[model samples]
Target chain A: MSVRHSMVKGMQNSVGYFISTFLFGIMFGVAAAASGLEQWQGLLMSGMVFSASAQFAALEFWQSPLPLGTIAMSVFLVSTRNILLGMSMTHHFDNHSTGRKILWLFILNDPGVVTAIRLDSGIDKLGYITGYGITLMLSWLISTWVGFNLSNIITIADFGAMDFAGPLMLGIMMVLFSKGSAASPIPWIISGIAALVLHEIGLPAYLILPISVATGIASAMTNRHRSHPPKGETRIKANNND
Target chain B: MTMTTIIMMAGIVYLTRVSGYFIGLQFRHIGELRPILEALPGCAMMAILIPAVRQGDIVDFTSLAVVLGMMWKTNNVVVSSVLGMAILLFGDNVISGS
Candidate 1:
């Protein structure tokens, strides 16, 4: 594709991602509100934390008065994917200035990582990453505030019904993640079994996040030497050059 | 917690987030840890979903129905969520009536 065409396609993709991400943000806001966080606090969490899982976990831990170490550990375990995401983009970003790389690292969430992996050229990586991050950040900030404010207007019963929005959004995210994967079911099965066993053993509900991560990592590590390319493989010859 | 306490808690949360960036950059070169890091989110989702499916203080027939509906309607998140809530409400009413 020509530079112009690629730019346009990138723009179109960014816009579509922004819209879906915004809806997901609204869902986050609703969930946060239902969880009893005040309006401004929810907005602040979205703006500052910028992570759905961490934010939700923090909210749950809020009432517990858990030690900082415990909270940090949970957040660390949940947000560990950012590390893998950072690795995948490192080759593409090797040539960029240190400041740009730092900024990218700061904003590297799942969507940003996914967008980076899908790019056809390394030249567009920074642009797409920036676009995805900025759009996601704005949507999260605004929708969180909206949900917080909306919480007061809606009854608990309504909020209970709407609470499904967050999980449903995540389920959609998983579907998006699983596209084109012939062996996707394997990881899902392994993770599901691990989760069941852990829950039966009396692990906390939030621990599921880390357990799933362990399961996926174990599965991936065990199969790493396989012949197939890992899932979400993008073709960026420029990346190799960088 | 008091308003002042909540505000302080929020500040701590912000610090943790900023800390993640620095931590990520520091450990960026550690490629050996990549697979486990990548798989954590999926593992977490499964962990949460398993208990969510069973009958208990939080899980029940209603929750299971919701999860099943979500799995079945993989594309329509809104519909699945609504169906799940409907089942929960119906289940709640039936148990109370009984």
Candidate 2:
């Protein structure tokens, strides 16, 4: 596809992804409000914090009046994977202007990183990243506000259903990640085991996240010999063929 | 929430999002971290998914059936989500007598 066509397609796909993801945030907001947060507080959490897992964790601990330090640590541990995402996409910004680069960096979320990796045309990397990020951010922000404002409209009976949104989204992510990969199930199995063991041991809920991440990372590193991409010209040709 | 609280929360959130971009750039020269970083998404997904799968309050046979069905039948996200929601609703009504 031409650069313009690619950019337009990227924007179109981004809009669809954003709308779906935004609905998830709205569901989260409704759940949080049901859990005791005020409508505006839920909105602010979705808008500012943006990490669903951490926000849900904070909501769970809200009644306890946990220390800010503890909350910060939970959020940091949950979000540490983004550092790797940012590193992976750094090459795409190598030729972009500094301002554009900074904006791209701000919006780099899971979907953004996945979409960036899928792009074949390098010339429109900035446009694709910008379009994807802005779409996702706006959707999340708007849906969160809507959920907060409409929390009362949703029944408490219905709120529990909204709690399922997090898992549902994660399930969808699993499906997305499984495409074109034979070894995809290995990390998933490891994670399931880690989660089961942690829960069995009665580990603090917040700590399970980091433990799962650590387990998966360690497993992936150990199995790197099985899936390492060939280097240099051979790798480039292989990628291009795909 | 108070304005101070909002500011604090916002600062923390922004720091998480932006720190990767800024700090990751500096570490590019290290070279060794790239392969490790490439595997991070799988790690993160596992982190989010594992505890979710094991939640005592939530997980049940019906949900497991739903997960398996979704993973096996279509693996299409939209379809799987619908299947999951349907199964959860059915399970809830049957289990809770609601």
Candidate 3:
């Protein structure tokens, strides 16, 4: 398919996310304004960071004179997942030009990357991701601005269970990422168990992602080895037995 | 927040965004790690999701199940999500209210 075609398709796919993102952005703007940010400051934050989760978390720690250390740590921790996300996209971005890579990565948010990977194969991955990113960024920035302006009128409580949207998207993403393969469920089960155990045992919240992912990776690796029968006669026997 | 703080936060997030790609690039040629790379995204999703779901009440659980079932059946993220959210809103407002 042509790059333009893929880009337009990407934008179309992103329309699904735009609504939730726009709502969330308005909510963020209200929260940011209530939290003592000027209109420009909130806009700047939305524009520069472009991460709703991290921006929300940072707002929780927003204070006068700037608790730099606390806010920085919270932002970093909330953003840690993006690193893995970026890593996952390496295959898609590997062939693009350096400038393209930078521009694409600049707008790389969760919804965009998830959509890029979830969509059908054969389209121009670069164009698709760029389109998805641009759409989401625009939705976020515009909604945040709107929310900021309407802060005094609509309170955060005006939205009910809106936070659930993030988790819902994540859950959808999990299904999308694991739909085809037989053994794919194994890693998710492992990751879930690890996350629960770590959280229950009082591991720092930030540590959960890395540790659980490692366990999942280990399980996948082990499962891969087990599924592939070892050596000669056993392998043939295993295949025939199947 | 000041420009400096905003810059710092942006810088930190931007680093997270790009570092993973660069890091993955390092291991890109490693034939052995390909499976791990492939599994990373799903695992990461579960790692974040499981705890949140665990902490949630019945409404959250039901909605999650609905979301998963719909996605499994249809493979349409948008529809599954909207249905999930609808269930969530319904459960929270209607069932719980009644």
Candidate 4:
């Protein structure tokens, strides 16, 4: 497809999660208002930061004295996924120049990156990813405006069942990524259980993602030989290696 | 929050988003590591979602199952999600005896 066509497709695909993104924006906006941030400040943060999880954590710890260190640490930790996401998408961006890559990565968010990953590599990925990211960013900014103005009338309960929308989005992405993955379901199962156990064991929330990811990778590597033995599976293994 | 804090947070997030790409660029020639790299996205998603699922009760689990099932069948994310949310809302009301 042409770049413009791919861009339009990207925006169209984003329509799927529009409600969830809107609700998320409202949640952040309400939180920002509750935490006493001026509307412009909230919108500015949304524009600059562009991460719901990090912004939410920042608002949670927003205070009179402003524990800058704790807030900063929380933001860093909550967004650790972005690092892994960026690394995963490195192949797609490898052909682009550093300036273009950095400029595009500024608007990176989960839905955009995950959708890019789901799309066939043959497509115009740069356009699709950029279009999707820009759409979500605009939706987030507009929803923040709505939620900020209506904070008094809105409450957390107003979200209700829609609260699950965010989780559902993540779950869908997981399903999409797992469809033709080289690692099989074993790694995913291991990672899920590992994350649960680590969280139960009182591991710091920030440590969970990296550690569990490492565990999943290790499990996949170890089970690789068994799943695809050397005899007749060499071709499959070679393909997987690529 | 102050402008300083906002800028700092944005800087930190931007770093996380782009640093991985640069790091991966450094190791591009390692063909052997491709499988591991390919595995990162799904595994990361699993790790993040599992704990959140654990926190929810029956309604959440059922709704999640519905979501996954719908995705598996229809492969339309928006449709699956709307159905899942509808199920969740219906289940929430029913389970609460409302």
Candidate 4, lDDT over the whole model: 0.74
- For all candidates in order, the CA lDDT equals 0.57, 0.61, 0.74, 0.74
Error of 1 at B67 (Å): 5.3
RMSD of each: 8.2, 6.9, 6.5, 6.9
Per-residue alpha-carbon lDDT of model 4 for A1-242, expressed as tens digits?
77778878889999867776776686567657767789999999999999876786566556677767766765775576677677777778656677888898888777777788888876777778888888899989998998788666544434444444445556765676566344478877898789999989988545776788789889888877676566657887778999
How far residue A192's Cα lies from its native spot in candidate 1, in Å, is: 3.9
Instruction: Put down candidate 1 lDDT per residue, A51-120, tens digits, no spaces.
Output: 7666554443445454454355545654655555555665565555777665555555666657658666
For candidate 4, lDDT tens digit of each residue in B17-44? Answer: 8887787777766445556756665666
lDDT of 1 by residue, B11-63 (tens): 55444434544555566665555554555555555444455544233424455
TM-score of each: 0.68, 0.70, 0.61, 0.61
| Lowest summed lDDT window (length 10), candidate 2 chain A | A57-66
Evaluate model 4 with DockQ and give the value: 0.44
Candidate 2: stretches off by over 4 Å: A1-13, A51-63, A67-74, A94-100, A110-124, A149-153, A156-164, A178-188, A225-242, B1-35, B38-61, B64-68, B86-90, B96-98
- Evaluated at residue A155, the lDDT of candidate 2 is 61
Root mean square deviation (Cα) for candidate 2: 6.9
Q: Chain B of candidate 3 versus the native chain B: what TM-score? A: 0.68
CAPRI class of candidate 4 = acceptable
Q: What share of the true interface contacts does candidate 4 keep?
A: 0.67
Kindly give the number of clashing pairs for every candidate: 7, 0, 0, 0
lDDT by residue for model 3 (B1-98), tens: 47888899999989889887888888765446656756765676677677778777788788899989988998876577667766765676666578
List iRMS for all predictions.
5.0, 4.2, 5.2, 5.0
Q: CAPRI band of model 1? A: acceptable
List DockQ for all candidates. 0.31, 0.38, 0.41, 0.44
